[model samples]
Target: MERNFLRRLITAPVAVALVLGLAACGGSASDPGTPGANALSGSDQESTDKYTTEKVIPLEEVDPAQLDLITEGTLRVGTLSDAPPNIFIDETGKFTGFDNELLRAIGKKLDLEVEFASTDFSSLLAQVQNKQFDVGSSSISTTDSRRENIGFTNGYDFGYMAVVTKTDAEIKGFDDIGDGKRIGVVQGTVQDDYATNTLGIEPVRFYDYNTVYSNVRNGQIDAWVAPSQQAEGQVKKGDETVIAESVINTQNFTAYAVNSGNKELLDALNSGLDAVVEDGTWNELVKEWYPEREVPKDWAPGSQAVKLP
Candidate 1:
């Protein structure tokens, strides 16, 4: 009878422990229905929080007089709607790229909200000049002709004009692209000017980069000329095209453009650019967008020569 009583005590405790263990496992604090639970891992949460934070710049510390904002506290920016690596709308409907991120950083420093206006590349400068936009943030190259109508900030990037052709095209280099061959270029761009004025070729014009790529892929055009980075991006997508050679080897730097009369706004943009460069924000953006390309250490807007790393 004593032995039986001891066995009962041991078995009862064992059964009770197993029941509690199963109950605890069924309703853990880390489970899906737990209150205040997070589904994302720790690293994902950090990354999400980094980009989703609304308030990056301390507004209270910024001087309102310096901003000279167009709409009280908003910076009106004009950019291309489809140019990738510079400014473009993604599949997820998010505005992102090197230029977009840089503008966002500039807005943060000035304690202003950025309102982006999408338009064609050809119209960016004219819109800025007409005061339709406070600034143009497209990958607008700084040239003497543009300076006559718009004030350019210090150049933030240098780009080369490249020629791209089909992988099996007989064109091996710029020299092989004869005058009789049909070439495609974005209208009102340096490439267009080169084809018409410099190369003495009557080139076909397209408004958007995708159209140019499609035309070349479908044999609608023999070759296309655009910025080296833009051409490289298309090539990197595993398309049936390749960057044949750089036609314009000169240093063409790109910068933000403002109305010629808006000195105050220009000064504010320069100040913001200085802040981003000094605080490593510019480097972070460059690393993110142009991971394979090198940004010069002493590079500032309008700096003449940029050697890629």
Candidate 2:
């Protein structure tokens, strides 16, 4: 009788476990539901709560890289070498820009060696997604779409775009900006999307921002619609022909986007970002590069790819 009673208890527990196991198998949170970053297809994850940002989350407990710190010194960072004052190269063949300096500051806090791998801004998303680098330092924009794949740090540079041209240019607003104007865009970027869709203009695309700038400055094209920060660099560095007008596309936000799965790296990046913002590092970078305008929030490539604010 005692044995039978114990067996009944065991059978009941086993039945419950089997039921719960089946439920878990059916509803596991990690299940890839749809396309786009382990999401459920045909399901609108727009309501997914994962996008809700925790501004000051700590990276120590969360980031996986710390757990596997094989190198102990290097934190490979990805950046766009074209966005001046944010991430760009100097005439001396040195990487000297806004994001360049800020990311170095982050490296100091983490006690890690920093290496910059420069590529097209569009690749920032894909490379970070693939773990090509530890963090993305290019001034990336944050949006619902980008959050789907890569995590984002708090905003760094926030500004608008400018209508730059050789003539005392007549490209006043978004509408006329593309009207009969041969617009230029960096290849494989949200800028290309904006040029093709919103601006209603066919973009004279280049492989990188420098080419876009080169083509615009040499008067090979009428104007170049680039980030205000990039345009600011050109203006400060003496691009006489290009003029930045207060067009809508010119004024947008940007941020440093990182791949999402690496919670440790994301946390560290955000923590470093918080430190930077607190010690006035963020604002100082703003003042150093853009002393002329008010810096807003942030922008990311592939971030919703919405019209520039």
Candidate 3:
């Protein structure tokens, strides 16, 4: 028997398929049909009341010019192991990636300790609303629907979604996917809605974000709709291929979300993000995680901020 000593990730949501023993955050408790109540209604959320993530960090490494607040301890972050580049256990059994590095710098700057709480991707927003953690550093995109449930900071990074499949699959779009076609996605995600409604396709929802890619690679699932950045990582790890590039919906912004009503926290996040970008730490992290892609010359924190009509 292989000895498995994987620890659960605390910052993001896990897929339903990722076994509890192997999952970073356990699975979400949300009912797909019922959106979670305001954070006040959840029990585990009590940790967030005085919940703070504080640490001392070297801005020079991530951003030297930013206003630094040296806090007392680690910031408890929630996550689901549903996506990579943002969160994942590399083959080396270490939790390291885009979200991890960026959050580390943020914690260092704020002087907060960093702890990750792993859960199901489907349960992330509800957990955030419930105050399950201080922040969600996952690469979550901002959708008006989600904004209605929780507040999102300005986009820290952006990437579109795509459909990955076998090189030989005959899929053009939703019409090509069928009941017999086992599509993979994290339950309660935008990809879930897209596959179920937009594309008019039904998918096999997995527990761990990795299982989708795993099933697809093994020919157990026909395709997977995933974020572009993470898709590449899964492909490289599992030897999969991208069959199509899905475009972003017109109204969404890639962003980090916080519990609603936390204006002070939101302000801090925006301020920290601006400082990161101005001092070039944002660009550096982008280069480190996604060397193949490029940030728009005009892209900056809050540059994408828009007033709802």
Candidate 4:
């Protein structure tokens, strides 16, 4: 996985262009009528207050034997290899990013080993529910619909939604998104749900960030609705793409996904998360990875027992 991601990062320019060209020729945009394409609605969302306010179980009370982990003392995590700064593979082929590193810290608190595997964002949640991985560390937003299938730890991060477009394009901001524009989004993402349900438009769904952002740069798509941190990472100098607009949605806090049946693992993670937050590891990682974006005063990670420094 590390070698594959390294190769992809090294050959991104050539590979992205080829992928965009092929996608354009084959009409890869998802049909709105298709199941899971534009299927999300307001009903999918639920208040996260329960997760935010729930008292974390004491760390000592967490029994690893009851956690039903894939491995006895290791957390086999599922994450993306493309979305940067939060959950991507670095140039050295190391899975060291904000989300993964934060999870590592939590594992340390729990006296567990943290291991990561790269997978598509589309299948990550389902894979976690199926116990393919002990946790999903892809900056997943916890929603009511998603909760039906899998469980989530208390939030460790917040995020912003962004729209990326060519510098010369007419789409300047979020409001500029309307009918008759070719908008791209990662499949099975909150951005996909927003573009489909809120904007009332059919979106071109790509499996990974590289492909969607590639289409934006190549003019094959007018805009890409993406996570702000990832958009900033991808839209580098002279890339011909810019993050035209970004809006913070504090309602949906980003958390680690776990299997629904694993209550012990969920409670254990929440305890570990509170530990990190209380010790200031969470704040440090936020400052390190998200230097450009400030943490909103109204928001903080972990349970109410822990506060950001």
Question: In order, how many clashes per candidate?
Answer: 5, 24, 46, 0
Q: What are the TM-scores, per candidate, against the unseen true structure?
A: 0.74, 0.70, 0.70, 0.83
Ranking by lDDT: 4, 1, 3, 2
Provide the overall lDDT of each model, using Cα atoms, as 2-decimal numbers.
0.61, 0.53, 0.55, 0.73
lDDT of 3: 0.55
Residue 190, candidate 2: Cα error in Å is: 3.0
Prediction 3 TM-score vs. true: 0.70
Write candidate 2's Cα lDDT for 131-168 as tens digits. Answer: 77767776564444455566666545443345567655
- CA displacement after TM-score superposition, residue 172 of candidate 2 (Å): 3.2
Using lDDT as the yardstick, the better of models 1 and 3 is 1
lDDT of 1 by residue, 153-210 (tens): 7656654556789989876654565466889988777667555554556779888888
Error of 3 at 207 (Å): 1.5
Task: Estimate the overall C-alpha local distance difference test score of candidate 4.
Answer: 0.73
Superposed by TM-score, candidate 3 places the C-alpha of residue 202 at a distance from the truth, in angstroms, of 2.5
* Residue 20, candidate 3: alpha-carbon lDDT: 19
Worst 10 residues of 4 by lDDT: 17-26
Question: Any idea how many clashes model 2 has?
Answer: 24
lDDT of 3 by residue, 1-309 (tens): 111111111222112210011111111112322222111111221111111122212234433223221222545677655467778766876666887777666566555566777777767777777777767766776654565678776666543556788777775443355555678976766666655543445568876667788787788877887766677677773374654544332224456667778765565566555556556776788788888764543333433322111
